[model samples]
Target: MSEDTNATDDRLRLLIERIERLEEEKKGIADDIRDVYMEAKAVGYDPKIMRQIVRLRKMKPDDRSEQDMLLDTYKNALGMA
Candidate 1:
């Protein structure tokens, strides 16, 4: 209709296209990470534990220690320590 409307439509289309491209890239990266985990499993490594370790590594050391302490406290309370 108007030039302003056309501009707005073009900008919206560009934004959507950019997001779609980024989503595709994210999926590709996730697949690559999955492949690496599969390779680790094939070589006898435990993927579940590996994932936990990766998650822990991303946390601060103090936070990790606090979490471990809380886990131990809960375990001791349950008499499963």
Candidate 2:
């Protein structure tokens, strides 16, 4: 085989291996997230809202302020504000 072909094949192999490793890591992280949700539910906390709260907490302060404004708007619309 030519050097060019060998180089291309090596690149393809490396890309495939990297993708496979990332996929496996993703699955493990997903399973861990699911386990955390189950544990939260067992402890009487709503997992869905807990997840949303965690996500919001990770946002920048400016982004969180915007989210808070929207939430307040929603509450006012529902006459709960």
Model number with the top TM-score = 1
What TM-score do all the candidates reach, one by one? 0.95, 0.83
lDDT of 2 by residue, 7-63 (tens): 999999999999999999999999999999999999999999998899988999999
Q: Scored by Cα lDDT, where does model 1 land?
A: 1.00
Task: Provide the overall lDDT of each model, using Cα atoms, as 2-decimal numbers.
Answer: 1.00, 0.96
Model 1 residue-pair collision total: 0
Off by over 4 Å in 1: none
Model 1 deviation from native, Cα RMSD in Å: 0.8
Task: For candidate 1, write residues 20-65 as lDDT tens digits.
Answer: 9999999999999999999999999999999999999999999999
Cα-lDDT of candidate 2: 0.96
